[model samples]
Target: MDELSALAARVWGELAQAVSTRGHPWRTATLATVSPEGLPDARTVVLREWDEREQTLVFFTDARSPKVQHLQHLQHQAQAVLVLWHPGLGWQLRMTVRTEVTFEGLAVTSRWARLKMSPAAQDYLSPLAPGESLQGLSPAGASRPHFAVVHARVLALDWLSLNPEGHRRARLCPPERAAWLQP
Candidate 1:
């Protein structure tokens, strides 16, 4: 492989390791999207899956969530960003991605089946959609069709490593572009 390919592979490898490592804060990334009003919305979401070959990342959410609507509005302009910071490791990854929402079909069905069997499935069982105010906590409900899986196709990966001596930063854009940048 060429130099840029190797660098991209290494960056992806690090991200894959971070997501797979239990208790690592990197497992949770801040997902940022643009609201219909042109406002920015961000929330912490769990990293569900990472495919290095496809250069994609996955996250789960309720289809009725506001973010889902934001994604729909994006459509062809479905650009989003995911930021991951690991204080212990002193590494930060800011990823530019094209987002795709999957509510039905094979991918969603398989994920829903697996999630339904896991304790985390409770998140998708909410009677009221996300951001709704409640008088009290509602009992866990059964899994519903609102469960969705979001796939993000990586467009660019900007990695920053903090160090006492000197910090390092690198940018990797798909198909064969990568370079170190001034930190």
Candidate 2:
């Protein structure tokens, strides 16, 4: 393989390894999006799927959440960042991505079906939308169609490895382009 392809492979291999390893904090990433007013908003989300070939990452979220609104408004820009930090490995990955929100479709239906069999289904069953004040606890109900899937097409990936011996950083761009950066 070419140098850039090798770099991308190595970086993606590390990420996949991190996800596969148990108790790895990198399994969750902080997704940062911009609001309609050009304000930045961030929240923690579980890493659901990673497509190496397409350079895309997936995460599930509530459709009614503020982040969804932010994503909708920023869809034209399609610019967002996902940050993953592994303290044990001392590695940080910053991915700049183009965001796409899918609320209704075969993909959403299929994922929702699989989620229904697990406890995660409860997350979509809430009667009240996210960030709403409630007078009392609400009982869980059937899964709502509001469960959404977010696909982030990675535009650039910056990997920072903070080793005790020495720190290393690299930037990877699409179509086999990579460069080492001073950390």
Candidate 3:
């Protein structure tokens, strides 16, 4: 492959290796979304899936989640950001990708129902809906019969690596030429 592809591949290798090792404990990333007023919001969530062929990432959250509300308000901006850091590797993925809520599709429900969860984990969903202020500690100890699971899928990642040895900060952008910029 060409230089761009080579660079991306090298970084992807680092990501895969780092993710598989015990060097870094920062596995989960902060997903950031912006509202219409240019306000910022973020939440810490687990890494659900990754597709190498499509170059995408996925995670799950409630449909009525505050982050989902912000997403709905954005309407036209279909992209959301995921900030990941591997301090040990001195690398980060300023991941930019298309975000879509997966729930209505039949296949989606099947995947949801198959999720491995404990009773305590299921307690997060209280049937009372999200964002609704509850009366007491009752909701905190409640559980839904069958919790709804919605996933946010992201595609197309932009990676940046810091080479402290050479004082180099390089960047890789896709679908075009990749260049190293001082960021």
Write candidate 2's Cα lDDT for 1-183 as tens digits: 876568678768766765566566777899998889988899998877778888888889988899888888855787889999978778788999988989998979988888877888777778777897876856755445569999988998888889989998888765556788899
Candidate 1 lDDT trough over 10 residues, lowest sum: 137-146
Clashes of each: 0, 0, 0
Q: Which order, best to worst by TM-score?
A: 1, 2, 3
Q: What overall lDDT goes with each candidate model?
A: 0.85, 0.82, 0.61
lDDT tens digits by residue: candidate 3, 1-183: 976678788766654554445444345778888876778888876665555556655666665577666666756666678888877767777776567665456745664566636543453456655667776637353444323343444345566667756544445645464676666
Q: For model 1, what is the C-alpha lDDT against the true structure?
A: 0.85
lDDT of 3 at 45: 62
Q: What is the Å distance of residue 54 in model 1 from its true position?
A: 0.8
Which of the two, 1 or 2, has more lDDT? 1
Cα shift from native, residue 29, model 1 (Å): 0.3
Model 1: lDDT of residue 120: 81
Displacement of residue 69 (Cα, Å) in model 2 is 0.9
